[model samples]
Target: MGGRGTRAVAAVSAAAAVLTGALAGCGPMDDIGLGQSGAADGGVGKGAALGVSPLKNPDGTGPGLAPITTSGDRAEARKLIDKVRTKGRGPKTGYSRDKFGYAWADSVDGVPWGRNGCDTRNDMLKRDGRKIEYREGSNCVVISMTIYDPYTGKTLDWTKQHAAKVQIDHLVPLSYSWQMGSSRWSESKRKQIANDPLNLLPVDGSTNASKGDAGPATWLPPQRSIRCSYAVRFAQVSLKYDLPVTTADKDAMLEQCT
Candidate 1:
């Protein structure tokens, strides 16, 4: 990794350092700094640490988008979601994934895991999932893994055979981004957003397909319990790119944590 990828990693590291250990506590409130529940753990947990509270992993540098189960954490989630700007969606004309870059392209600049000889999809898989198995003699191609599907609140025994068993979701969907002024953005910026780890999640394939370019107003994770944190992740991606969701989408995002 170099350029933006390096900085993204560093920024995430800094943000995570203070809360990483605290996140291991029993409740969602402990994911952030809701209160002093107990003694701090030694350090960051492993990739097996799925269902990580989104409140503590603001940069999307951690694991699964865990549910905001506690009232305190839900309140914090709402606050984050509330900050996202709102606008009407724009035209989708001339929009295509290629405009951003190749699917999961590694060459995108200014994103975590970019230019690291691995595609964004596999990078996300390794980041949020565990029990990973890479292709023989190739570390970049993920052949299999067991992942927590936060959207459905289920664990999947995934393999490459049915690639759709798991998918890399763009928290801010590419088509949604196109409508939210990304259509006019430079190709580099588009590619950066497309590949940025902060905007990506390895999630349930069916749920991701169902979301298909829709914003929070029209779609949410199937596991209603995780909605607030999902909205927070959406807002984080939007704010990072200086993009705006539709007014309805913003409102719907607020509903999740309230």
Candidate 2:
């Protein structure tokens, strides 16, 4: 991730007077159930006490990517990890952002947030962030919000003005997907994988960027506790897209759960 933030602040001076949420995961409205690896909007990974357990969110619909600390949850995470097939990665000869569709394209059909009017990026922001501050006259354009970031185990005060602070990460990167045989998929199928919520996470930008195109073998979240849950999420996306991971990546993923 670039050192610079990605969002363009519309009115910085005005926002100085606006209120931002101080504690993200403690409230009832922002979190409930197993949200994203357990990064549920306002709640997931609020830490060991506040986050959801991955065992409860098999579908990857929940928000945050919390750690699987319980023995049972870890075992379940391993079960999910075992489901992904192992194989060699293909070459990255003809990969590019355009290969999947414009970044966060809402028109991509057959994905959860597709055709939802809100683009996938904002949809994910709304999906995983809490105490959202939308721009005046626009609920879809989030100006700022508090996020419980599972990767670094820190609550982030983020604004669209500082987009890099909070990025919508592709849990299974697009280029990695290409190398894993997605290159052969039809454009629509590629689009589905690219925009799917199951494949996305809202995480600290630099941490997310540090994982550039790396699979589980080469990179995992810095937070050790969340590793098992991260692997489960990766496996979930792989299965959903009918994609495969490299043999080493699959092995490493399982090790996290073990």
Candidate 3:
């Protein structure tokens, strides 16, 4: 692994240790089934008590969205959110997933983990999963792992058979980005944002599905304590892409930190 990849793994390892300890203390919960794909937006549960704060993990190489608890950090989160430009969303007339390139393509450049010999999805899985077991004879294909879902504040032992339990979420949903000026962006730029680790999160699939195309104004992670961190991440992607969020969304982002 290269420096970025190493850093990503190291970051996740540290977070996984914390979550694993938490799980050990609480004991495993009953299998309540799993969702298909999604993040952030969901019902409340155990909080993601430990992980890299978005403020510290600006590159998105780190694991799990930790709660922004300090007032100073919240103020800083708000400052970043304030820098994001706000405007009305555009029409989604011509938008399709294809415009941003194929799902989990490793071909895109200018984003972390791109062209890193692993697809974006697996890169994410490796980044956020613990006790990961790769596919037979394959270093890049993850077959099993334990995922600490920051959105729902739960953890699960996941295998390839139940792959949908975890999802790689576009923090700024692709469709939401489309409406927020991504439609005017170059195809390559769109692909960069689409595959960018900074814009992605691995969380409960159903929670992620609940957040489809919705902005902070309408949807947020069920783990209330991490809302500020989530807002910071949303702003990070917006600023990086030069995409303006909606006025309502920006307001909501600011409110999360305050």
Candidate 4:
């Protein structure tokens, strides 16, 4: 009887040891550092090693969000047309021809080329030219520049050799705007529009001349795939700046955007 009792006691002890070992293998039931399972005390987890927090939830519900709507609206465009009527008439030639043979007027809104040390050509060169190397000690002038032509999808090296190749295109062409509502704008406002980044795009000079102040109804970028995006951006800029769009222009934008 004594022998049998001792064996039973030994068996029970062995069972307890096995259960303790299993529990120890699981480490602890408490939260580990950086929520890593079986991690050493105070150790950061793999997420921290990757420069991210393991506790962060990525569901995109942070702040300043509004519901997105897919519906198209032309209200802003109409409002722009109305506002432009208040500004008074724009230039007569509508930036078609300058005395200098450039497509743009020699002066916009009485701000003459090289007047007050401001030249439209130089201004445009500074505005559109990329990788610009400035003339020494001249804050307002660029001696040489480079640009990527969105219209042609080509990078143009615009040194003095190809200075004329890079043209500043009006997003709302001057002629088109004149017909729509610019015919009534103050000279200052007209000048503002002429220099406005929203209205300017760098393009091949010849191509821009070919476009010749025409709206979407008549001309588009040479690249057909960009037409929709171009029309939409043009419409948005016009709407933002209170430029007018003719019925035909509106129809063309709608066709492209839709």
Candidate 5:
């Protein structure tokens, strides 16, 4: 927590300053639950404060990915990106989703939100979503929530019925990881990277699908303001696992911070 951390914290703090107080008069808005009425009545407003900056949320446990504003934070982001090693991407011959363990297994040890009775998807839904509604009789199951999709800068009134509308994106896509040498990793290591909150983001599904296995070199969030933050998150995951990004991807990431 140096200059970079302090500045990023200040950015989030200033934006959140307006939201410090609770809802004043809980009249009709409280009837259908706070967030349940949001989508129907246009209650959930859009703003940059909907999330926390990657500069402060290195562990990715905070909330959504907030844009990284200010020259200082961008400079700091570039420094972090510079630390990631770069190499030519390998091959994708023997990779599969199963190779990283079943989707969102709570049983995976050593990662945040793991083995917490809820699966990783719901955990992320709870973590990034605001005004959450849970399925009846289950605290771990999320029925609906208001989410700010940083990838597209859209606020969604997401429900379980249309589960594919929002997807948890891997900042470093698993297939990309395979090409970057994850195929040579132990199953446990692969699972850690796959389930690690630091590498995951709840974003617009279509945007994420369009990303495929492409790195920063080829794909990025459509919201220009969030690109640097996205690049930083990518670097965080790479550094944490001692993984190497492709040279092109690393260069692209550095450019985002500028």
Candidate 6:
């Protein structure tokens, strides 16, 4: 039995050598690292040590990250909206031009929070801007940062001077919130909505101004291609925050989504 086993091992080794030699001359099997392991065949190392090839499209680009969606609970959003819609407006809130400078607000609700405290602009600057550069080391607050504009697919090197070039857009405008349900909310809750990342997007400054407290029924992205994702985000934010949408706004959203 031992002699038969030895003979079988010898036959298998001989067959493997023959097969390896045959395959080495052609095809993808040309560089099998059998005996000359490591630095052989131009430093390819072991066969099993190769890294995975990155998946790419025919055009050689990798897939993009999925679009942003609402983070707050939808039920909680609805409750908040219901609560705020019934309430009356809080104390007259005023925003300083020095803090926002050149950024326009259409209604009292547009600048819901006072001065620089809990400003949507600052919140968005923190959330959307990357590699933030501050005016002074003493001021931990960011004066500027790199922003990627999803609307136009452009990277903007935003600075404090050009900060007005990007604006924090409310997916559901504050005035819409006021009419729908925010009128009923406490000052604290209103401030939360103002600073919510889920509702804020850094978009073209002029475009955001033009949007001006309008709902989906009245406004859509000037860049037509982004409208779908914009509508989805709008619906998600409103539904999450319990903000009521008019029939027209709902219809427009459906059209954009479809």
Best by TM-score: 5
In angstroms, give how far residue 24 of model 1 lies from its true place.
18
Which digits, one per residue and each the tens of the lDDT, describe model 2 over residues 183-240?
Answer: 9999999998888887888888999889999999999988898888888889988988
Candidate 3 stretches with Cα past 4 Å from truth are 1-49
Steric clash count of candidate 2:
14
Global local distance difference test of model 1: 0.77
24-134: candidate 1 lDDT, tens digit per residue: 554344433211112132122343344567778766666667677888888887777777888899999988888988898889777766798877887777776566677
lDDT of 6 by residue, 144-166 (tens): 66665655566677777776788
In each prediction, how many residue pairs overlap at the backbone (N, C-alpha, C within less than 3 A)? Answer: 1, 14, 6, 8, 0, 10
Task: Evaluate model 5: give its lDDT.
Answer: 0.83
Q: Which TM-score value belongs to model 2?
A: 0.81
Candidate 3 per-residue lDDT, tens place, 186-227, comes to 999999999998999888888988898999999999999878
| TM-score for each of the candidates | 0.80, 0.81, 0.81, 0.54, 0.82, 0.53
| TM-score, structure 3 vs. true | 0.81
lDDT of 4 at 151: 70
| Lowest lDDT 10-residue stretch of candidate 3 | 30-39
Model 2 alpha-carbon miss at residue 156, Å: 0.8
> If both were scored by TM-score, which would come out higher, candidate 1 or candidate 5?
5
Model 2, position 251, has a per-residue lDDT of 92
CA shift of 247, model 4, Å: 2.0
